[model samples]
Target: MAKGAHGSRQAAWEFFGAELKRRREEAAFTQVELGARVFVSGGYIGQFEQAIRKPQLDVAQRIDETLRTDGFFERMWRKLIKDLPFEAYFAHVAELERLATKICQFEPMLVPGLLQTPEYTRALYEVSHPFATPEYVEEQIQARMDRARILKDATRPEYWVILHEAALRVPVGDPITMAAQLDRLREMVGEHKVLIQVIPFVAGAHTRMGKMMKLMEFEDAPPAVYTEGVHWGNLLDEPGVVKQVQGSYDLLRAAALPPEASLILIKTAAEDHRRCAKST
Candidate 1:
């Protein structure tokens, strides 16, 4: 069965866990015994059963083989993940965004996802998936817009974003789209909805110039750092690594233009886009 929507991801996971436990017991295998077959630790098996962690696809397949469920676990894994709006690797990050009390992000060459306009998102998707059907592209665009709604919630996280000047100057969609997107950023800053800073081109050779990172803090759990590369993402929670990432973010923040100045830059960028649009 397919999960319904955003809130249903947890329910789907719980179902996955319950089914795993039932099948494991039916096979008369202890968690340790099952772990041996799946090449994971007994504690890891327990974590899966408790839904404390999600297993990789290969592990799910191994579990299916070990329990002789005829690919039941693998199918369930696909159902749970495939229905998500985000990419498989980014699904967990979307979940974390809802739980975070504060979020700090640095983008080197693009506007952060939460601030992207539909036209801008469409242009990006079209370029990335040249052969994708219009329906599929629209679906992805809607998903991105839905994700942006986190900022609208009354208990929204404290959002802080640092963008390199390249993000502002690069034309995403046409001049019209760029103008609209920058105007959106200007509105967010003007309303005090978010804290934004820009690292101008004048500030060269800075830390995190080629990396995009997000730091999220939760009310009860330890903070985490997320970094993404082409087609992959890594979520880091080790205390040492988190501390180091936090230090790097601090340095980047120090190198940025303040909120007031950044807002001005954003407005200027919007005007430039407007002029370009009029010319073309």
Candidate 2:
């Protein structure tokens, strides 16, 4: 599969789903029955079969075992999603995010992908990938926008974010783009789509500086933590590590301004950007 090709990604996922349905039938098991063995709901299995959702690696492994396919599902999953726009280390996290019931994120610098606007994302890519083709940057922006869609689903996770003041102060894209981006956050907050808190510069140094971490909780599986740097990402499911990360996240949350106050600050920041743009 070619990298960052949306059509190819969808087609490969469809093929994976078709094979899953065929094998389940060959094994004389209904979707509900298969889902039971894999520890997901019957509706979830149907979604997978219809390519409406992608199963995570562990679930794929369970499907392989349940259908006596040795490693077919697992292997296919790895091969099919490897070409996604995300880095190799982050592909798994992307899949898992779909299944999460809650997501708590801390971003010390730029806005998190799930909350970033298209213009904001494009600006980041332009500066970061200065020599890349426009197509590559657009593909990445599309992927980010796709990732953000989970927030709009009726079954959307309970999303919460803690942003350092720096994220709001940093000028990403043009002033107009920054204004729109911050305005989007304010809108999401007002619509009750997400809960947000911002750590002000006065808070001084605190936990989780110079790092970004996301804690995800699932209904059917243990929680996971994802951390990312410039070129790499890590996913941790180990209970101890997850616990520690959770504690640190709690600390960060405590240091942040209350949601109402944060909303006011965001509004102010958006106005600042808008005024700056107008003055220029």
Top candidate by lDDT: 2
Cα lDDT tens digits, model 1, 1-280, are 1224654777778778889999999999999999999987776688678765667788899999898999999998888878777889887787788778999999999999999989999999998899999999999998888888889889999999999999999999898898899998988877766899999999998997999999999875678889999999988777899999999999999999998899899889989989998887
Per residue, candidate 2 scores C-alpha lDDT tens digits across 102-172 of: 99999998888988999999999999999999999998988888888888889999999999989998999
Q: What's the true lDDT of residue 142 in model 2?
A: 87
lDDT of 2 at 180: 93
Q: lDDT of candidate 1?
A: 0.88
**Candidate 2 lDDT trough over 10 residues, lowest sum:** 1-10
Best by TM-score: 1
Candidate 1 to truth, TM: 0.82
In candidate 2, which residue pairs clash?
none
Error of 1 at 111 (Å): 0.8
TM-score of each: 0.82, 0.77
